[model samples]
Target chain A: MTISFTDAKSLNHDQLEEGTAFAPRFDAHGLITVVTLEDGSNDVLMVAHMNAETLSLTLESGIAHYWSRSRKAIWKKGETSGEMQEVIELRTDCDQDCLVMVVRQTGRGAACHTGRKSCFYRKVIMTDGTASLEDTGLPRLFDPEAVYGG
Target chain B: MTISFTDAKSLNHDQLEEGTAFAPRFDAHGLITVVTLEDGSNDVLMVAHMNAETLSLTLESGIAHYWSRSRKAIWKKGETSGEMQEVIELRTDCDQDCLVMVVRQTGRGAACHTGRKSCFYRKVIMTDGTASLEDTGLPRLFDPEAVYGG
Candidate 1:
């Protein structure tokens, strides 16, 4: 049988605080934020969102799935880029509004569509009263143009 | 002089892709997401938001600051709980709308108001068509009532 979540709004503090139930609180948009991290290294890979369907799929398949608000669809990570994330552990915060997933990234080990190991490839720099971005110089593991086509 | 960001709406692919300028595209709420992780352990401590003022304060002071959307105020983390986060590095995502901060958590090393080392203290459980939260059993580093005053 597939897993399901409890309605957070209907649960009491005692039930929420002490009960061992998966009660995820989705926003009005029917989405919850999920942060993915590379397991061994604990490096953040990407930050995305998940709808109930995607969340259930991730739990059932042991793979990472996300809700693409931009495309308004469910995205099976690495379905096209071959960079799948195998879930090692999934944890929820106090209110269960956010999720953190520890996973072993398969294939190219790149999480960003740009082929970088991480989506965050730059740092902010303040110079002469201006703020700018400076590349961290992380090398791309794959050629995006070759994989996704320009 | 105070640093400012360019309006993301006015920038094109070339300007956004190749330019060094920092143009954070805040959502309609005038807020951007910020995730905090412990510097050495790399465990995610908390996920919060930043308004322009708090973001600038974090950049200028090297202290992690956040916007409390519920309280509608600027919060200097650890001010009440003594769990200040000293920024070791600050990074922005490829598009500059999200941020990740690696910090050295001060005082008791707890980042959660729940008195836990990290805010994520539970994992979801799915068994026999039932779903619930299982406490990760991370010890409470402090007493919330004592720190915040009951």
Candidate 2:
């Protein structure tokens, strides 16, 4: 069955922001940004994008699905690896241009392709007019090579 | 003085993903996605965009700056409402295409234009075959009309 969303074009500012309608304003690429966070820790695991189909699949199956920009296809996350995410809660921002998803990380609890629990493992540091990065010392939970196989 | 970044074009995959270089990969529109979170509660405040100029300004001032897509200009957040955000930490994803900022919401302790502590005040509810939204019961910390002046 095909699922559809309320047309955001028809909603006024107040209705869109304050009302209960689920009209997501997809960007020109037919995608909306999604920020995924681990449910227990509330740590941001990854940031990804989803098209209407993946969004429906996510809501229907209670699993996280995303649109891989580089691959130009629907990505059932953890299909290749064993890091599936169980959706606990899904939220939309006021303007409905972005989404926040709380999920329970399955398998080895890794949420990044680099085998880390979170994609955001490095903090930006600015010193003497130059900016660099410092690792937060988050250790990898799994081996990407063994899981993804080059 | 103009701040510059280590051009992402010069970085290889390993250098960009695993190295310490702060090479942010801006999208085709010369903007990168930013996710802001409250420092203590860790609730997502808002999702925004940042160009090189706003990115530099944010780092230089230790305050949050964003690219206002609607206004087509640099937005010094809280400039109008006194809810300025003092960035506590800035982080980049493994691919450097997205950013996470931990901030202390000043003034009225609100981080949303709607006068709420968070822009993500509603949760998406999928029941049966339909989807809608349910408010999270987060009360507005300030009045928009009195602050912004209708």
Candidate 3:
């Protein structure tokens, strides 16, 4: 059975924000942004998008599923890499256009396809009015070439 | 001086993902997704978007600035509600299409327009194939009516 969401258009602002209804206001592309966080450390794992079908799949299965804009298909995260994410808690924002998912990252605890613990492994810095990215010293948890076999 | 970004088109996959250049891949709308987290607690405060100008503004000013889709303008967060966010650190993902900002939420510590500490103040639960939202019990740090004036 597919989980159904309330119609966000039918609710008033106060009801949408403060009520018990789970009406997600998807963007024009029928996608909602989702930020995934590691359960215990609260570290942001990755940011991705989800269509309604994938969202429902995630809720029903307790595994993280996302819509790949590039692939234009449903992506069951960590499926190929043996790093499945087990949902701990799922949250929606005030307007319900976005989501915060707390999950236990399985496998080697790598969330990024690049074998990084978290996707955000580099910090942005300004040097002489020019912006550059600096590695945050987070070593790769696994070798991507060996795992993905590129 | 307006900060310029490296053209993402010029970079190859390895250069884009594994290199040190800070080339952000903005969407067709000229915006990039951003996830903001509370500095110490690592709690996600909000998810928003940043156009190139606002992204530059944020990096230069060390304050949070977002493209307000509803308002169709740059939103210097906490400018009106006295809840301005001072950026602590800024990190981008492997692809640089998304950003994670560590910030200190100022002025009563509210990050949501609803006067909550974080925009995500509710949890999603599925019961019998029906999804419902449950309050996470995060109290308002300030009164919205008094702060924004109803």
Candidate 4:
């Protein structure tokens, strides 16, 4: 019973509107898990939150777009870094609350700003009666020090 | 718009009540996504699906259990294959319709039956008017013929 359960109660604040302008809205923790789908192998490139605009852009451009909560704007993967993710198919849960973006990676590195190949490059382990981070070996695919001159 | 948009819905037929003796039930499609917590990474390792018993044993043993829809029954990951997942945390959406099982992976291979490390081992792209898979080097850790034997 080490695992405690919590609910995404914030989602209760809003309701789904089904109309021409009815774009789905998610609370703080809602997300689109953009996955890299290559040859039947898949890995999560990065996770992004969706605003109506980004979702629309992704639907139109075939590239994943997300709302940066901190930047307060839309972020297209590999926009500045060139590590773009070209989405192949966008699937949603039966409820339409969450989205799964399966894409083909178009660049050398991951879609994260940190340069890691995947945002999920770390692993967690509950040992010694507590969970800790384990590096998954895939790290900053692009050499930032060589590029930025550390 | 070929796709129809709808509100979020969940299948809440099965409820676990400590040593509850019974068969678990879900709606037609059943539960199709599981949010597994990637231990150290704090990132989600992957999202998978389960029927009912897998969900049950997951709660029972603290080890990840999933009903392989493909195999069509209760399947304990890593039980025979040594690729088991250790459950650390569990969560649900506001409606309790979906389930999230955070786990620690025992990396003999992928949680996915596919040769790749994870089921999410591919990336896709739109080109020549068709979606193509992006080679993300998903099977870096595994050789299908090597582990599962051709």
Candidate 5:
């Protein structure tokens, strides 16, 4: 099958409307590329799924929204955690089957199942010095309980 | 373009080989879904990425392997943290785009950063009260320091 290509930097890319599942509209289908904010430390402070609606919401609101598996529903960032993710930029890969979201994580903590700061908590192993199972550093500056709860 | 459908229960359905990434292989592109495993406490010890290779490895070794993005390699579960994720059984969604990796987390703490056990450490907003972010009991499990030793 033949597929068309479009450059995200200069394209008709815009905020999708309500009820639009960005994942389906763009045909990105099943791939979500999460960008790490901190250069060396990959702390995930949010975990959002892109099906389309939330994708558009992210683009429009400049915030992150996701599909909560446990809740089996749509979720808006900072809706409860008070930790919102601001969109820095958005990019789609050459194949268009995936999307990359660059955002600045608000609040302090990982954006994953684990309460670290990034979704990439697990480190990768290689021939070189062992990679961090994940970037782990809660330097008081990122303790929500200390800041918010305390 | 039209897409072909396949049986997820079958072995040929987007399986992956377990190990960290060495180099991007043709089969690496087969990863279409992420399977999650959490014990009774809502503790997500680890999250495994399944391409075609690691999926097969899950069946063979009964452990988890995922595509290591940072290291540009493949990784086996507990290969580093010793908190290996033993495969219990694998389940796929209706569309076959993702899989539910029901696994038993054999570890000291969590499979995440911030030294918590499980990728999901806390729950943000439970809109419908359907999901509660069960605290895996605050404690350091896989000490990134002790293991990696920065």
Candidate 6:
């Protein structure tokens, strides 16, 4: 009894729009974009991609899992850092090429490998036609160097 | 002095982490992921992609612009629908491959082609090894057929 999704192209408009079918449309690469947000506050924690296996694991376990394109492996969030994300809600866009997961971040509450609360800790500033970045001053919740080592 | 970004590979730890340089890492297709969120509420409006030109325009004009992969064209969000998103803040992740935009949604406040307030209007439910979607019951702010024509 494992949860599963249907093929997006096979679904009719009613099923796609109003019905209960969960048909996700994966890109040619067999990956779908996943946006993770912190529960309650809804702050975007990170953006990643998920393959079918990782997606199913996330759904079955209520824990966040992502496909690591760079490593060519499946990533179980917080497996190494103890910063797991427990799914509060999972949603998909109109066509289902994208996913949104509202989760209760556990442990140190940092989502970025760099130890930031969120991956996006810097703002882009454009002034006088020149662009630069400014730190948002969000403190790091953990020491990545200590956790992952050099 | 037109704003420009450095090649992602050229950035060192300091340049990538703390420096003011804005070096975005575009994918092989020359696109970067952009996530839009409501300014005050932080509600995720939509997720899209941007090419270099669209990214520059977004920064220069303080308006959201995206690259439509399916259409093979640039998209000025809300151009025909009058749902322009004014950028209040633009953020980049640690490596700069992703962007998060805090925007003031203008016009009807609908960010989805389906006429919904946000692109994600349904929640996914998995019970007894079966997955389905449930409408969040968020009313349409406008009619798509009326706005874009049937």
Off by over 4 Å in 1: none
User: Scoring only the second chain, what is candidate 2's TM-score?
Assistant: 0.97
Which pairs in model 6 have colliding backbones? none
Candidate achieving higher lDDT, 1 or 5: 1
Q: Where does the lowest 10-residue lDDT sum fall in candidate 5 chain A?
A: A15-24
Candidate 4 lDDT, B29-76, residue by residue in tens: 665356665665543445656765566556556788776655776777
TM-score of chain B of each: 0.93, 0.97, 0.97, 0.68, 0.65, 0.95
Cα error of candidate 6 at position B88, Å: 0.4
After the best TM-score superposition of candidate 1, give how far the Cα of residue A88 lies from its true spot, in angstroms: 1.0
Candidate 2 lands at a TM-score of 0.98
Candidate 1 lDDT, A1-150, residue by residue in tens: 567778887789757655666788898899998889999888888899999999999988889999998899889999999999999889998777889999999998899888999988887887766778888887899998899997
The list of candidate 2 runs beyond 4 A from truth reads none
lDDT at B74 for candidate 4? 74
Report per-prediction Cα RMSD to one decimal.
1.7, 0.8, 1.0, 16.4, 17.9, 1.4
Lowest lDDT block of 10, candidate 1 chain B: B124-133
Choose the strongest candidate by DockQ.
3
For model 6, residues A54-98, the per-residue Cα lDDT tens digits are: 999999899999999999999999999999999999999887889
Worst 10 residues of 1 chain A by lDDT: A13-22
Model 3 lDDT tens row, A17-66:
99999998889999999999999999999999999999999999999999
Q: Distance from true position, residue A53, model 6, in Å?
A: 0.3
Looking at model 3, residue A19 earns an lDDT score of 96
Q: What do the candidate models score in CA lDDT, each in turn? A: 0.86, 0.93, 0.94, 0.51, 0.44, 0.90
Tell me how candidate 6 scores on lDDT.
0.90
Give, for candidate 4 chain A, the lowest lDDT window spanning 10 residues.
A14-23
lDDT of 4 at A50: 77
Candidate 4 wrongly placed segments (more than 4 Å): A1-25, A28-39, A145-150, B1-34, B37-150
Report the error of model 1 at residue B71, Å.
0.8
iRMS per model, in Å, is 1.6, 0.8, 0.7, 15.6, 17.1, 1.0
